[model samples]
Target: MTQLPPRFEISRQDIARVVAVFYERIRGHPGLGPVFAAHVDDWPSHEAKVTDFWANAILHERSYDGNPVEVHRRAGNVRPGMFDTWLALFDHVLAREVTPQQAQAWSALAHRIGRTVRAGVVDQAKGPGGVPILR
Candidate 1:
């Protein structure tokens, strides 16, 4: 019989570390800085929410139940090109902070979530009189 990979939970400290590292990058990153600056007003609250979101996504512990897609959509206009920049930033952070396996797993999940959010937002944007859905 085939064996499954070990099930592990990401700790709160890990989530905080990841989000802090990621936000540090966002602060300096040319592509994402302005977007984040413009949309994110409460840095502390935003950081906490992001930490919870990543924890839930990676650990499947349901630490967060917020809709990221809806949040992103409602926050402001996200240019189509921003997704590429976001992915690149995530890859950089993953390389710096996580194990190879952890990085790979996180990247895969990020891609899936990005794709889903993009499709949903794009679809809503195209619908007549429909508001873009944010997380």
Candidate 2:
């Protein structure tokens, strides 16, 4: 059995800090802001949910249970291309808010999630024979 890398010692406070900063940037971004605004009716609740998600993912807390892929698919406004902008903002905030080790560890997970979400969106948009449907 392959041993997993030792988890980074990030606290819930640290996760909350990063989530707060990251979402603040997302809410202000031209491309992402409107997309989020269209889907998210309650900012505080959404922020709390996101914080829980990050805390669970990074700190191994078992608090978050929602299916992120299904959430993004239901969002309808999120496209595959948006992951780039999201990750860029995420990387920026992660660098400023966390230690280098934390940033690296969190970024790897974030990128994997981003790619999965993007693929889910893309596959949903594609028809048989791998051709993308015109929106």
Candidate 3:
């Protein structure tokens, strides 16, 4: 049986642009910048890998090969809360880079992926349940 194609159309170039712009913003973000800086020594290589990741997720291409959850969990510095900040910035980039339909679809996929990553990272850490996230 033939597999159905992705619901929305997005190109490798589009993914590359989004990844590039998003990372540029990330490097400047106070909360996220430091976190990413601690891990990523090379921005262009990181962006290319991330572009491959999105292409695999959205375009069904076989460019990316790795587990994001495992990477985040291993990072140790990646907090569960960081996914929110990451997604927010990513969505902002999507809004400016892609068509609205593509952005919505990509954002939905991203949130789903983000939640998985968050769950994986959160499982490795513990906090007092009664304590609030923000004081």
Q: Give the alpha-carbon lDDT of every model.
A: 0.76, 0.84, 0.87
Report backbone clashes per prediction.
11, 0, 0
For model 1, give the 10-residue run with minimal summed lDDT. 1-10
Q: Distance (Å) between predicted and true CA of 39, model 1?
A: 1.8
User: Candidate 2, TM-score vs. the true structure?
Assistant: 0.88
Return whichever of 1 and 3 wins on TM-score. Answer: 3
Winner on lDDT between 1 and 3 is: 3
Cα-lDDT of candidate 3:
0.87
Sorted on TM-score, best first, the list reads 3, 2, 1
Model 2: residue 58 alpha-carbon error in angstroms? 1.6
Best by TM-score: 3
Which one wins on lDDT? 3
lDDT of 2 by residue, 11-122 (tens): 8888888888888898899999999999888887888899888877776667888999998888877778888889989999999999998898889999999999888887
Query: How does residue 28 of candidate 3 score in lDDT?
Result: 97
